[model samples]
Target: MKKIFIITGEYSGDMHAGRVAEILKQKNPDIEIEGIGGENLKKARAKIYCDHSKMSGFGFSIKMALDHIALEKKVADYLLNSYKPDLVLLIDYGTFNLRVAKRLKGSGIKVFHYIPPQVWASRKWRIKGIKKYVDEVLCIFPFEIEMYQKEGINVHYCGHPLIKQLPEKADREQFFAKHGLDTTRPLVSIFPGSRTIELRFLANTFIKSAKQLQKKHPEIQFCISHAPNLSDDIFDKYINGTDFKVIKGENQALLSISDSLILASGTVALEAALYQIPMIIGYKGPWILYLAYLLVRCIKKVSLPNIITGEDIVPELIQAKFNTENICYETEKNLYNKEYRIGFIKALGMVKEKLSDKYSAEEVANEIIKAL
Candidate 1:
């Protein structure tokens, strides 16, 4: 039986890979799955070598590492030599997977990447390394294909997998009732991000923004939704003085009812897009990382909503722009301007056009089976 190695990092990457693996299994059940992923992928029958708890990010300290980096390398080497997968389906974690790709290059195992690295962002030169290591790059955004093709590497646009999981209709009333929110008021959702580092940086920004927003529209309700991985204390500390509702595992539901969303750019921007919610994007990383962003000369736009739309459809309050006043100004503009809100809705329609009609999981699975 042909074996496939699935590699992923973090909860989101594992979730993305799990959906694809589910689709692939339906396409060809005979093929076996083996590699590193979270519980979601393991539940899908992919043998779990290691979860993302070990290889989280470059920011993770040496003491925090669950196992030595060499241990992960040894595991990859062992898998390559033993199962000899026909293909390695690499999800978003480029750090470790890229290393594995380099180590196993020319071994005859085709490397298929599900999520393209931020080549459009600073590391545009990384495409050379990616093309050298990866056999095929499957990207979620239409714009990324153009960026990669420009570099002489043609990438497949698989359409965003998030579209498949996006709810057709959100229970606005139920969500409000469950969260003890007043259904009558216009809601503004705040997503600082899933990481502690990000929450720490942007929490004050989000709070300051929301506080300023309250001055303009006292009736407008502010809600801060927490990612499943984070604790309430983190968000509570930030939103303390303000009358903000603390919610968990209800990002979609929060967006559904939101008149406008203020988020730290990344995956949440995409979520806002899927929900057709108008948003102001914000970000404040370390000074060095911010400098690196400029040094690398990434795409002019950082938010996914802006990137996918091929225009600055939503206002991005990043780095220097991530202030309470700026965020509130953008939030109020989107909330009160009928023309602006309508334009955002129109942009969302254009975005939906670029996505696949079929379920993402099913489509991803069929692609995996074809490779086998």
Candidate 2:
């Protein structure tokens, strides 16, 4: 029986890895699928080599640095020891996974990467590491193919997994009724992000933005998405001083029903785009990381919709620019201005056309199985 070991460093990666594992099992039930993942992977019936919560977070300290090294040694040693996998699949978590890729050098283990780093967006230097270590990249974004091919790295363009994986657009009326939100009011939802650090930088600003909007349009209702991965204590620490209903889980459903969104830059922005939900992206982090990003970022656009279209479809406010004033200004344009809102939603509609229609998980599974 063929065995594959998957490594993922965070919740989103875990979810994507879980989907691929589910399809891989269907394609070859006798094959072994084991990985470091969370609930999603466990549900897909992949063996839990480790839970990624320890691996997921923001910023880095000496302790964090040490923890990562220890975890890297643990995973690499485990893979080389008694549980040698036929193939090693690295899913996202570019920083950690790339380090693992380097450690696996000369080990004779074939490594295939799914949802590889967005070299087109930032830190193009990382592509050298990718080219050196990754045998093949199972990429999600259609445009990444050209970048990889130009650099002489083998890449396969699998349609973005979210296109197939996202739940159907929720019934707005039903969703509102279940949440006890008034259907008559325009709903604005804030997604500070899945990480505790994100809440630190963004939850207050998002709350303030919502308050600003509500002050002007008193009838507008509000909710905040608490990523299920985060503990309640972490969310409550940053989210207070507002009565906005905190909706835990059901992120897609909330996105579907929301009229406009205040988002922290991440895959959720892409998910909102898929639903044609209008949103503005705001993100702030440590000055050191921001400066590092500025030094290496290849593109001006941060949000996926804007990056994908090469146009400003969704407004991005990052670092110093990511303030309550900017978020409310951009969000209100999408909320109150009919022409701007319609135009924004139409631009989002075109993103799907720019992507591959191929079923991503099925294609990914077939590629991995074929290589095996």
Candidate 3:
């Protein structure tokens, strides 16, 4: 039997890894797969070496750094000594995965990186490290190929996974009725984000904005999306006194039915764009951390729809501008301005055309199978 080891460090990464595992298992039942992930990978039948909870976090902390360093050594030691897998797949959670790749360098084990770092977005210098460690780069964005080619790195432009993974628009009537929401009112959704740090920075601001927006537009029905990766207690603390319907486990469906959205900048922006939902992105953090980000960030825009189209299709409120007032104002435009909302939706539609139609996980699976 062939052996493969995979590593992922967050909910989205684990989900992506799970999709790849599902395809890999279908292709070759004899293949044995194991990984560091959560429920998604477990459902896909891969053995869990370690849960990604320990690996998930947003910023620098001494304890987090030490924990990850210890994890890297443990994972590398196991792969090199006991597991001795034929191929190792590294999903995102870029920093941790890169460190693992560096440790596994020159081990004669093929290391394939799917959904590699966004070097084009920031820290372009990391491509040097990618070149040194990873054997093949299965990058998601079309623009990433040139950078890799320039570096003389082996590369494949696998169409973005979201393109194929996103489900068809949910039945709005059914969704609204199921949630006890009135079909007569325009539904607006708020996605604070999946990370605890994000909830800390944006949740209250988002809730306050929703309250204000509701006061102004009494006809609008609002719901807050609770990212499933978050524990109930961790999420509840953020929503304590806020009284809107809290939607959990139906995020994509909620996105499909929403007339507008207030979101924290991340992959969810792209997911909303894919659904062609008009939204405004708001994200802020500690002043020091924001400054650090500004120093490294290569792109002027943060929302994925704008980044993919190279135009500001969605309004972004970063740092100083990410306030309750701005969020309400932008979200209001998305909800009430017919002409502006139409144009925004049009631009979002173009994003799908710019991406490849190939099934991303399937391609990754086929390539790995061929290599094995």
lDDT of 1 by residue, 69-110 (tens): 685578667867787888888888776778788888888998
Please tell me which model should have the higher lDDT, number 2 or number 3: 3
Whole-model lDDT per candidate? 0.78, 0.89, 0.90
Clashing pairs in 3: none
Ranking by lDDT: 3, 2, 1
> Per the 3 Å backbone cut-off, how many clashing residue pairs does candidate 2 have?
0
Per-prediction TM-score, please? 0.90, 0.97, 0.98
- Deviation (Å) of 342 in candidate 1: 3.1
Question: For candidate 1, what's the RMSD?
Answer: 2.5
Per-residue alpha-carbon lDDT of model 3 for 1-372, expressed as tens digits?
Answer: 999999998999999999999998898888999999999899999999988887885347887788779989999999999999999999987888899999988888999999999988888789889999999999898988888999999998889999999999999999988999999999999999998899999998999888898998899998999999899999998877877999999999999999999899999888899999999899989999889888998989888888888887889999999888888888888888899989889889988988899999998998898788
Give candidate 3 misplaced runs (Cα > 4 Å).
57-59
Name the top lDDT candidate. Answer: 3
The deviation in Å at residue 325 for candidate 3 is 1.8
